[model samples]
Structures are given as C-alpha cells and as structure tokens.
Target: MEQPWDYLRHNDPAAAGILDALANDRTLEDIDRARILTAVDHAAHDLEIRQRLTAELTTLGSAAALHPSGLRTLPGTRFATHNMLAGQVRLGRVVPTANSALMRAGDFGIDHDVLRTSLMVIGPPGSGKTRSLAIPIVEHLALASLAGKASLVVIDPKGTDFAYDDWFDITIDPLNPTHGFSLFGGATNADTAADRLTAALLPPNVSDDKAYFKDASYNALYDCLAPYHAAYGAWPTVKELLALLRASQSVHDQVKAALKGTPGAKEWKEHLDNRVRQSQGSHDPAASLVERLARLDRPALRKIFDHQHRFEMRDINRPVRVRVAIPEADYPEASRVLARLVVSQFVQTASAPDTNRRIFKGLVIDEAGRYVDDYVARGVQKVRSNNAGIVLLTQTLADFPPDVRPTIFGSTGCKAVFGGVDPETADHFSRWFGDEWITQNTVSRGQTSSITYDDRTIFTRRSGHSEGHTQSVSSRRVERARWTPSDIITAVPPGHALMALATSDGNRVGPMLVNLRN
Candidate 1:
C-alpha cells in the first residue's frame, strides 16, 4: 500500500521534499513544512518569473496565472507579516495606559516611521467626533507634559463640551476665556471684551487704500454683535443697523434740504439758533441724534459704538485655555465668530513661542467645518508657521470650501476617518488610499441525469456549464486599525472601516480593530 506521500511525490515533488524532511523528525510539530508548502504552491501557479516577482513585490499573487485569468494582478491586499507582528507587540496594554499622553518609540512595523504629524478626526453628528479627536489630543497633551513637551489649548464650541478640569490644570470660562493670562480690558461685559479684542487683533482691512470701517465692517459687526448676542441672547438685525445708518445720514440730509427748500428756512434757523442760546449753545444736531437713539433703545449702535474694550492675553509660557461661548441659545453666527477669534488667538499666541523654539502647542477644533470661513481657513493655513499643530473635525467633504480643502487635508498629515453614511464622502476618502475596482467572471457547471422519451434507454449522463461575472471594490492595501466606536459598541449597526497609518514611505499599516470608549 502506498502512503499519502506517494500522491504528493507524483503530483508535487517540492511538497514531497518538505514532507520527507519532516518525516525524519515526525515528533516535530513545526511550521517549516507548511511554509515550504505555501511557497511551493504559490510558485507552481506562475509560469513566468514576472508573476512571481510581482506577487513578491505586492505580497499577493494567485496560482496558475491563467487558472484565474491571463490578466495581470496589481498589489492588492498585501501585508508584511513581520510588521504586523511587531505592531501587535508594541500595542501591549495600550488601553490601560491610554489615559494620559503615552509615547512609544520603536519600529511599529516594517519601515514604519513614528507618527510625528498631527491627526484630524472627522465624523458626522452623533458619530462621536469629540471622543475620537478631542480625547486623543488631551491624552497626547497630558503625555507630552511628562516628556517635557508643550501643552494643549482646545478651542471647544461650548465651555463645557470637554471635561479635563481634573485631568489637567485647565481653566474654562466661556464668558471670560483667555489665552495664557490675558483678559478683556476696558470692557464692561464679556461681549464687549470679545468684540474689542477681535477688532484689535485681526487686520482692519485687506488693503491700505480701503478704510478699516468699509473693509472690515462685517467682521467688525460680528465682533461687536457676537458678544452681545451670546450674552443678551439676540442677533442685532443687519437690516436694522443699515436702516439706522441710512436714517442718521438721511436725517442730516433732510435738515439741509428742508433749510434750502423752506421759504421760512431762515426763520426756522433763527428759531433753532434761539433754542441753542437758551441752552447756552450746548444743543447741537449730533446731540439731538444721540438723544433720539438713546430714547429709541437701538441695540445695534449700543453693541458696536458703545463697547470699546481691549482684549487681555496672558503670558506666552502659560498653558493656553480656551473659554468657549455658552450654547444656551442657538448661536450659529456667534459660534462661527467665536470659533474664528479663538483660532486666531491660539495661533498668534502659541505660534511665536514655536517660532522661537520655546515650546510647542496644539489647537484642537471640534466641528470645525461648520465655523470655518475664509478668515478661519487662512488662519488654519498659517498655523504650521507658528510651530503648532491643528486638528480639524468635520463630517462631510463638502463641509470645507474647495480651495481650502486640499490644504486642510494635506496639513493634517494624519487622518482618523470615522464611519460616514454619505457614499460620496466615503467614496472620496476611499480614493486617498487608491482603491482598485475588481471584476470577476464566474463559470458554473450543472449536472442532469435523465432518460429520453422513446428509444433513449437507461444510460443517463449529466452536464451543464454556465458562466457569470461580478465586480467589487476591494482595497489592495491592508492596514492596522483599532475598532472605533463608530464601527461598533454603541448597539448600533456595524460599519466597515479600516484604520491605517500612512507611513512616510506611503505604505498603509493597519485595519486593526480599535475600541471606542463608551
């Protein structure tokens, strides 16, 4: 009787060699024979050395290049066994030691570089963008302090969105937030202070020829009005402010027109002149207008013209604390304005130290796409020059302006993409890793046994062949990713996402399932 090895010898001499080698030490339960088998099996399928080399380079190839198809295969679903094992080892006790910033410096995978760039986390509403991005930033900041690195200044939308008062010595005052140790000076209220500082810090106009009033009027209006709206809970009507301006100018013009048109204009002027004499020349048209505005209780003039305050800044060395406006009322405009102001302040204040190499700081903005305008976008673009990092959180790709999108995406360097429901957004992101479209053709064989009608006697044979094709989107790249909350653990439906670190050499490292803390 022939042993199982006889069939191997006839069909695969290479497999027989490895099996014979293992037989000498039958007690050995080693993978050496399996490795040899796998290699041989793979090599046998490729007729030319080209397919084998391609497979080696891409880390994937099929047996019998034509058994599958004559078509050439690209690098897809490729992985480095050595790096994955290394990453598994480095990921030891990551969850337990995840509270504060923890730095592990070693080769996480093959040719893998350390993560030196800032990471941006983006997700839709209720998708936990705050947990994924802000928490990581806080953790990194906490860990950096231990490493003798700089701290973090998070520009949160609300004063209470993030809870780190006990974790790190943080100061939060939505009404009175300041960078370093600066506060609003010469301001009666929080709104006035924020307005004053915004006006003072940002450039008044785009050019020298333009008046600051004309050029920065909208921003100025935002600066002045945002605080009042945030504090008093109302938006100063734009139409109303415009109406007041027009009314003031109109009143002056009307008085001039009335004097010119009236036959008794000289008499009226004499009457006003007599009144001025009665008040000892104290009465004037400007005074009269002021009295009228005061009596009418115009909030527009009160917010801007009445509030002239100076913003306060603390020391450059102090830990940056952002006091976000309260979210008591739905303040979208206030949110946008305040977000821009805080971002500008963080960049200017922290950047100088970074340029001097004194210390590094990080600015974290959650839901950034909602608030970012041309002004905020420009500020975000310049953050790197200040020697600081920025993390912008958004859900949709369309959240950002087209021109600013590339810069924001490129600057992020590291991106943590959570699950997205929007297929367009998903497809857009899928392209970054270079997804390959796979098309497959299938052939089916069926068997039928039956006797024909009259003369076809007993013998029956079954035979049938059928074919079909299929197409799919499969990523050639395999990455190490942690299971995110968006992926699972919320009692919600599951989502498909692969976490990866895009190394400096442009290789992805994971699909490592990570857990998002509830």
Candidate 2:
C-alpha cells in the first residue's frame, strides 16, 4: 500500500525529490500541483533532466506572465547585466518557435563584451532604434555609474531627442557661453590646439583638390598661434584667433618676421606664401578658409569657444554623466564643429594608457555618421583595451561616406538592425553576417497508363504515382538575413529589432528577433 511517491523514491530518487518539493509547497494550488506533476512525469529520467525540469517548473509557478507588448529581458551573463535587475543568469521566456507571433515575449540580446568593441544601430525614422536600444543602453550605463562601475558621455546633436536631463550630472550647452565647455581643453601644445581648431572648421564633405587649402590654413593658424603660445605660455582664445585671421598686411609681415627664427616657422611661411600666390588666380584659398571659420564668430559660438571652464578628457573616468548638447537647427556649422571636437577629445583620451582598466567608459553618439572621421575610426580600432565602448546610431549606410563604411563596419563587433532599412544596407549586413548552407526540399509527380487486348472496342485504364523527397544540398548560400532589407523596410513593426552579436573570435551568434522593452 505504498504511495506513488514512495515508489519513485525506491526507483528514481531524482523524480521523488521533485515530487516532494511540489507536494509540500504551500504556494501552489491543487491545479498548479497537478500541472507540474504532469510535466515532471514527462521529464523524469536522468538527475540532470529532473533538476532542469524542477527549475522550469519553479519559474512557471512564480514568474509573472509577460504582456503581449512586452518582451522578456535578456538574462545577464558574465559580460552583461540587466540594467534594472540583479542576477548572474536571467533566462528570458521568449522562444523562437517557427510559428512564433510578433511582439511575443522572447529572449534576445547582445553580449556586453561585444559592446566594448563597438556597436552600430541602423533604422529609418520612427523605428524604435533610439527608445528600445539607445535609451536602454543609456539607462544601463547610468545604473552602472551609480554602482561605481562606469561613466558615460552622450552627444546629442539634435538637442531635443534626449530630454532626460536628470540622468546626466553635467550638461554642456554649445549655444550658451556661460554654461559651455571649452573645445581646447587638455591640449598640451599650440600645435595640437591649432590642429583641433582646423579639424573643427574643415567642412564635413570636402573634395581632394580642396585638401591643400585646409593644410595651408592649418599652417597659417599654427604659425600665428605658435609665437603667441611661446610668449604667453597659453594658447590663443577664439576671438584672438579670429583677430589673427583678420590681421592687417603690416601686422602679418611683422609676425612673419618675428617667427623667422622659430622652428617650423620656415615651412609655415612657405605654405602661406604658396596660398597667397594661388589666391591671385581663382577663389582665394586663404579667404575661403577664413570664411569657413567665420561661421563660428557669432556671439553664442564665440562664448562656447572662449569659456573658461574647459572639459577634460580624463573626466570621463569619473562616475558621472556628461551631455554635449548641440542645437543643430539653430547653428548647423557650429554644431558640426562641436561634435567633431568632442569626438577628437574622446579619442585622444582613450588612446592614453590606463593601469586599471576595469572601469567601463562609454561614448554614445546619436546620428553618429556626421561625426565619424579618421580619428574616430582609429579610436574604435584601439579603444577595446581601454575598457571604453562606443555606440553609434545612424539611419542607413548612406549616412556614412563610401570610403569610411568599411572601417566602421569592420571595427564594430555588434550590429542591431531595426525596420525600414534600404536594400543596399540590408544586403551589406546580410553579407557581413556571412553565409551558410540549408536543406532544399524537392517534390515530383508522375503517371503511367496502359491499355490492350480490345483495340476494336473502347477500353481504357490509367494509373498514377507521386514522390516527394528532401535533399541535403551543399550549395553555398547565405542564411536568410533575419531581417532582409525588404523585411526591415516593410515587415518590421515598431518596438522590435533584428540583432547580431559577435564573439571575440569574430564569429556571429545570432540574427534573432528581439522585442525591445520600453
């Protein structure tokens, strides 16, 4: 007259332990116990199997049900943690069944380590790229800051998108003088300062022939600033630099004569003389440089450049949030220059040596394509060792120039593709994710009939047979991109994205459909 539990105890101890736990649990109702017992019966075999079943049963019993609009959070691993939750491994409830429904709960996420290498997020307007991906990232970094694990810097060129002012400790308004940060901070020498200023003033899209003018302008600025720095032990202000650019002919001659004996001055003089000779023909190259820089001569921008409180690159290592807000609509040229300056500064800081690299630092650039240049590319290539991460957001591959697209794609270890992407961009991601072979199923049908004996009479008979088969074809093929460019353009709904995470060895883990939690 032994009970069923007793029978299991004598034969299968694993099963018996699960049964005892379920039966003795006070929280589970009779119906819940019955359901769990049925599942346990189906899974009762090896000890490992029983333990896994018990864990799942426990989850089912106590876990909150997911809403239709909600996607289960990605469980934390050694590389990444849930921003709001604390746990070593939090398994998501979403399963990728062949017939899975849209917006259903699912577990999909990129590794935190991959993020350190770099990340690119692309989607058209209103694709939830910012909310689902960027905002969550920012919140996670903020949480990490509070925990003393990381620091963050965000560049919001548009200004209006990031309204969460409370999340940041410092807000730099490039359009306001009193509350702005200096672009020339941390420059060790006059040459460095002049180079940064030149880069900021250079046009975003410039032709090859025009490159000489930029170099010549840089030389002129350097020649003027070098003597000033030597005499005063500090670099010139924006107003002072402008004054040098507007110097009278006699003043230019006097400064040139003064710097005649200085190192590098001879080369600078030659560049200036060449620029002057060239200006005698078509458009004046030096004048063009002056006009371009003149855009920053306005009151608001001048205040930003002349601000006394300069921003230091090393400040990013502290547990704080720094936001560089650029009012693009009001001052597009100045905004671009500020963005470039910030990127250059961050790159310079990241390139420095660090004794303890455990503290993570992040740079989040919204509309990043506008700011990416050779310096940023080089930084992405080297920042992984410094415990720094960069998150770049853009609408499409077209947002980047043709030459730079490869460097950006090659350096980034993680890519998240949202909906409404063009085919060209989708195809690029498709190829980047690489290719695989798949089974091709083929079906065929045939019929044969015969009639004989009485040709004189009218008699007929027919028979037919059908055949179906699946072939394991070895044709080289691309695994269908989780979301084709077409799929992104037409099929992807809001709040969901297709993500591909890469390992350290450069192997891709998934192009899974992830439902972003708002």
Candidate 3:
C-alpha cells in the first residue's frame, strides 16, 4: 500500500521534507495529521498547491516567508499565510469592534480584483500605513512578479523604506549618481514623451478657468519634441530640450532651420511656428514649463535625469519591479517634481494597451498626496480597466490639494483609514461611508408620587396614587453614518484600520474594521 507521504517521496522533495517536519512534532492532533495528509495528496497533483504548502510550512519556523509564491518575504513585517493565486494576501483578519454592521471578525485583504480598481490608505506616521498596508501590498506584488503573474512600480520619496533592491530588477535613484531616471520618460512616441514630461513639470490641479496653462504646456512640449524627434532621430537631452522649450527667436530660428525640408516640414514647422508666437505672450505655457523644468535641472542632478543610462517606464510592460527613489533631503523641490514625473509616467504607461492584458500591473506611491494631481485622479478609473491599479499612502486628505482630494478618494475602489488621523480626514471618511439604517431602542421608566397633579386642570385634577409606575419601550430604524468621525479618529487602535473594498466586478464591502497585525 502506497501512503500519501510515499507518493510525495517519489515525486516532490520539498513537500516530503515539509511532511517529515510536520510528522516529527508530537503536539500534532489526529485532525491536524488528517488535514496535512489531505493537503499532501492535493499538493502532489497541483504545483501551486505544493508551493503554498511549502510556504505554509515556513510558519512553524522562527522566520516565515509569508508570500504564497514562495518567491520572497519581508522579514520583521507581519504577514498572514494565504493562497495568493487568486491575487489575495490576508494582511489581517477583521475584528468585531466598530459601529458599522458591515464589519465582522474574519480574514481580510484586497485581492487582484479589489486591487485592479485601486487602493487608498490613510494614516499618520508610525500608524502602520506603510509597514502594514503599502509595503505588504508591494511585497505581495513582488512575489507575484517573481511567479510570473504581475508587475509593480514603486516610487518612494522617503527612498530608504522600500530597499528591496535585492528582489527588484532595476533601481532608479536620483542620488545614485550612476543609474538614474529619464527626464523624457523613455517614451518612443514624441507626444507621449512630451505629455509625460509636461505633466511632471506642470503645476497640478489647476482650476477650470485656468486650464489654458495646462493645455498650453502640453502643446508646447509636443510641438518642440515632435518636430525635433523627426529631424534629430533621437530624444533631446536636458540642455537641448530646455533650449527648444525656452526658445528665443534665435533659438526658434535654429530649431526651425534644423527641421527645414524634413518629411513633415510643413506641419511640424507650423507647430513650431505656433509655439514661437506663443513664447512672447504674457502667460506663455512654455515659459512656465521651462521654469519648472529648470528648477530641477541643477548641476547636481545632471547625471540623474540624463537621456542615457536612465531607467525608462516603458520597460514595465514586462514582469519587473522598478523603484525610483527621490532624494528629498537634498533636492526638496526636485523630489516633488520627480515624484510627479514618476506617477505621471506610471499612469500613462499603465493606461496604455498592453499585449499581455492578463498580467496585472501596480503602482505604489508612499506619501502620494504631495504629487498626485487631477490627472491621476481623473485617469485612475480608466487605468483600472486596463489591468492596472495604484496604491496610495497619505497621512491626511489635507496633504492633497482641496480640489483634487475628493476626486482622488472617489475614484479608488478600496479606502483604508487608520487611527491617529485628523478630524477632517476622519470626517470625510465618516461621510463617505454614508448612512445606514440602525434600529434605535428606547425604554422609559417613571414613578408618580401622590403629590403629583395633572397640569391641564391643577385644581380639579385628582392627585396621583401613593406611587404609579410606568414603563415604555420602542424601537425604530434610524439612518446614520456607518462610522462616525469620532469613531474613525479615536476608536481604531494603532494596528487596526477601517477599510471599504470593491471588487473589479462591482461587489462591494462597506467600510469594515481590520487588524493589520498578525
């Protein structure tokens, strides 16, 4: 007779070793062995199940690789064991400790479906927003990336936290001095490169009446780069691109002379001609863009955003993990500007049609409120359908522009609110959770003494008996916010969070409390 363990010994060594370890434990119960044997039998026939079982075995050890792919783990970070083939990692279980009826004690996480719609996490520093939510999500995607399932791009302004350089394929660091980021976003298309650069350079969240600034900046870059690429057969460097953008009539004449007799000379020349005409205006779009671009174009950053030896966002089409660390300490303003560039490029790249539609793509921006604009807010929903999603971490909604926060919040499918947040952020979550019907129960009890008399007829009314007892009970359904601002602000513990999730197919789980720790 061949036992399950024997079948395992003949086929998979990893599973057999894990089974031996499980069997040597004297504390194992009959039911535990039965489940283990059953799992072994299933795992023999299924490779993913086998991988999950081996990963599960690590739980008994001092350090566990929590990712089911068995590809990697984040040591010192708390994680749960779950089969992530469905694109789910159980970060924590739900806890029954909130006013909302939607919440219950159970396993909770955002699978690929919920993530495809996008995730937004709000919490203050030391509130586990990064350790518990953002990094774990990135780690989960990292494991998926290794298993040939998905791709991820993480842009961290703080830079040091996500030091998964060992696992990732490329690291784009402005301070690295060698490997760096592309100012032009490595876009093959001229308009795309121009749009990405312009988005990164343009001030975000402009009002409707002032949209000309945004439109003009986009047009100016495209006009220069499109003709320039057609003529030069390559992307312009910071110096060359800046000159074309900040062109005086002399510079414009040189640009025009270079493009003369080109294939699209007529139309390209006209486009450049329009840009030169606008360069003299009171509110020139190119002027504003050049000003912003030049702000970060310092001598210290020359090698970082260079055209050569730079990481391109276009490489994300394959399964890869890219980290672009912005040097906030030295280049404070450049950090913000480059952060916008990374996000703008990410959104643009993710939104483009991919040949491998099934491979999921993710973008994680720690402290995203500073750089994410109305463009990302507006385009995320469209990005969701393109098999990509973004994970945003913010201390408060206040960090973002007032005009853009609502749209940003509204666009994401998953919103996780952690403790220690400000009243305004809590208040927004409270209202955003909206109203739910709750039964209100009331009970009244009273005693009327003999001295009591009716108010309607004081003199004529008879006095009450020695004592009269009255009791009443009533219950009615009342509408109220599922969770109040006070609850969102004070009630949630440090390690726990309140999350609402919506699946890609439209199934929704209203805001529920979840414990982020193991």
lDDT (Cα atoms) of all candidates against the true structure: 0.41, 0.63, 0.75
Candidate 3, 1-518: lDDT as tens digits: 44566765765666567667666778753324534554555566778877776677655431222223343433444344544445567788888753654466788777777888999999988999888887778877776665455788898888888886455667777667556777776688787788888778877767898788788888888988888888778887777778777765676676678887888778888877888788878878667788888877787677777636778777666667788788889899888888898898888888887534556888998888888899989878988887889999989999888889879999999999998899999999999889777656554445321211112111222334534467555566767777889988889988999988988888888677888985
RMSD of 2: 15.6
Question: Number of the top candidate by TM-score?
Answer: 3
Ranking by TM-score: 3, 2, 1
Q: Residue-wise lDDT of candidate 2 within 22-121, one digit each (tens)?
A: 5677875332443344334434445675566556544653221221112222123222235332201121233352212233554555434666778899
For candidate 2, the per-residue lDDT at 430 reads 69
- Can you tell me which runs of candidate 3 are displaced by over 4 Å? 1-82, 205-210, 248-262, 265-284, 446-470
Q: Which candidate tops lDDT?
A: 3
Better of 1 and 2 by TM-score: 2
Residues 1-518, candidate 1: write the lDDT tens digits.
Answer: 44344444664555455456554765542222232233344444554543353343233322212211122211222111222211111221112211111323223221113232345566667776575435545544433322223445565665566654433444433334332222232234434444534443334324556443332333333333333333334333333333332334453233435456545555544433433343343433223322332432333223322333322332324333333433324544434444555565555554443343333456667767655545445555454544456667777767876766766666555565556435555555455534322222222223434332122233455456424433222223323212323332232222212234554334544433333432
TM-score of every prediction relative to native: 0.44, 0.67, 0.78
Q: List the residue pairs that clash in candidate 3.
A: none
What clash count goes with each model? 23, 3, 0
Residue 118 displacement (Å), model 3? 1.0
